[model samples]
Target: MMISDLPADLLDEILSRVPATSLIRLRSTCKQWYNLFKDQMFAEKHLRNVPKQLRVLTLKENRLFLPSVDLNFVPPSIEFSDELSLNNSNNSEEVHIDSAFHCDGLLLCTTRDELVVWNPCLGETMWIKHSEGSKRVKERKPMYALGYENNQSCRSYKILMFWDCDELYDGQVDGFKVYDFNSNAWRVVNYPNCFIMNSHGVNLKGNGYWNAYDDNYVDYILSFHFTGERFIRLCLPPPSQGCMYTSLSVVREELSVLRCVKGSSKIEMWVTTNKMDTSASELSWSKSFTMNFGFPVLVYTGLLIDEDKKVVLCNTIVGDHLRGACTIGEEDKYYSEIAFEGMSLSQPPHIFNYVPSLVRIQEGTELDVFGKSPRRRGDDPPTRRGDTAMCDHDFQFSQEIDDMMS
Candidate 1:
């Protein structure tokens, strides 16, 4: 029997097992394959079939890099691969990427003039211009976040933007907006006293969470529900007498807070026991084990936690080099640090958990609204320009398929 004569279910099973890098090339093999890969059901099934692994994506010198490390091995083996580089094309100048956030297999990068959503696996990028009101606002840094929500019938992604206003009215600011992919337009939203301290927000299960301060200068965990399009504040744990720093992160799929005391050498981590319980009074925070780095060092951010091995990945700066530290939870507390070989010390990297899949960015009404044409990699669309100096290394995907698979 011909391959085309095979049952639809059989075809789906075969395709779902393929690697995402190879699947990108196969999408253009024929119209039938293209349609099959683009189907929402196929995307969900493909994600389920792939074995989940811990991977980190970093930005340095206006380029994107994915570094994989095997925590199971002693001292952890580290490998680096270049992903994508932003530079001047024929039509526009090179763009400077301010910050990036990863959600559901897609990367959202912000430039001064616009925001771009890139699906590295599929080599597809979408450019979104800022709203007219945003352009007129005073010069203050803007915060961006990417999130998605799913229902019985369909799933949709949304981007949220809020600007730090120069002037305050009764200790309140008003530069909150959201972009819905389904609508293909930006809409202003009501955000009372919502000012995020982080450059980007962390997305978990259809909501974006941030470490934020309110009009009264009170710190809290701010949450924005994507489906409901509203904001809520969750109370934080009581502060230490001499707390030096505090930040928010995800630990084992739960909201976690990392606190550093003024005269302490160790960082204390707290995980929320009742994450699904949204009520402020009902939310509970439990103190996890402390990570002692021996000497007092800056704990920039918590990357991820390996539940099986009880290792936590974090970013730290040691004198001149940028390093990744692994804190182990064995009998005797120990930690190890590896310098990120080629990254600059100026721009510290932000790390996130990434899973490879064949998920498409635009779906349903979005596809019909945006033109039906396919956007190639080199297409000359309106671009954002940046002033950072370029690196000397050649910009390309340095690692081979074997390196990534291994």
Candidate 2:
């Protein structure tokens, strides 16, 4: 029997096991295979068949480097030779990526002028321009986040952008918008909170959460549900007076906060045990553990947590360099440094737990949705280096703190 004559179910089962990179090339063979590969059911099944691994993406010298992590066997230092650089032309203006956030397999990189959604695996990119209202508001910088929503019938990826407007109250913000990949259009949305902290939003499942505060200095968790296109406010643990720094992260699928308590050398980590319930009191914060670096000057930012190994990955400022450390279980309380050969630690890199996949940003839409031809592998546009260097204006930490640690 011919391959095209095979049963539909059997064909789907066979194609689901194929790797995403290869599927990109195979889709051109025929219209039937192309549609099957882009089907929601086929994509879900293909994702399940792919292995999940943790990798770190960092930027240095105007390029991106990705390195794999294995908790069981820690490496002295990670060395990355593979660089993901922009392929622009020598004549065109160079693009500077100020900050980046990862969701599923795609990365949302922000430049001064535009937002670029890039897929390193598929070598594809889509550029988006900021709204006209946002461009008019020059006081506050724009906030960007990449997230996905999945239901029984559809799976959608979206980009959210918002900025504070001076016309509103002190904490109030304006120019909130969302871009749907399927529609290739931007829609204005209501801004529920007064202000969102200038940090990357942590995405869990299909929702994104950020640490936000109001004019009264009251802190709360600002959550955005992608599927519903609505915002929900969740309460934070009562603030501890004189805390040095507090940051939010996603640990083992739960919302977690790392706070350095006042008048103490200990750093406390609290994880939300119950997140589904909307009540502020119902959302419980269970103390995961306390870390005392045994040095009065030590401060850390929680990066990722390996629950299975009982180890937490963190970045600590020591002297003039930023170092990576693994904090072991409570009883043992062991900390080990991750060794690396190149790259300066002066700037703390934005780190995220990345799982590579074959997910496409524009699967269900037509090729001309953006009024541009579809980009395939090896069709990258030429990139040129700009005269001026790009600075990390959105770097979360303050220079004063780094100076104090140094």
- Point to the candidate with the largest lDDT: 1
Off by over 4 Å in 1: 1-6, 10-31, 45-51, 70-83, 86-95, 131-137, 165-174, 194-199, 215-218, 237-240, 244-247, 275-282, 317-334, 338-347, 363-406
lDDT of 1 at 41: 79
Score every model by TM-score. Answer: 0.75, 0.70
**lDDT tens per residue, model 2, 1-406:** 9989999989888877765544554544565765676566677688767544445555544456554334444332334454456544233354566667777667887765667777655455666655442243456667678887776765688888777445444646666788887767778887663564634577777678777776666677788878778888777766678654455677655778766665565777778888542233335677777777655433434554456545555555555655454443343434555643364653355555555455666553344335653343323222322211111111111221122212
Which regions of candidate 2 deviate over 4 angstroms? 1-37, 48-51, 59-62, 68-82, 89-95, 131-137, 164-173, 237-245, 275-282, 296-301, 317-334, 337-347, 364-406
The predictions' CA RMSDs to the true structure, in order, are 7.3, 9.6
**How high a TM-score does candidate 1 get?**
0.75
How does candidate 2 score on lDDT? 0.59
Report the CA-based lDDT of candidate 1 relative to the real structure: 0.62
Candidate lDDT scores, in order, read: 0.62, 0.59
Query: TM-score of predicted model 2?
Result: 0.70
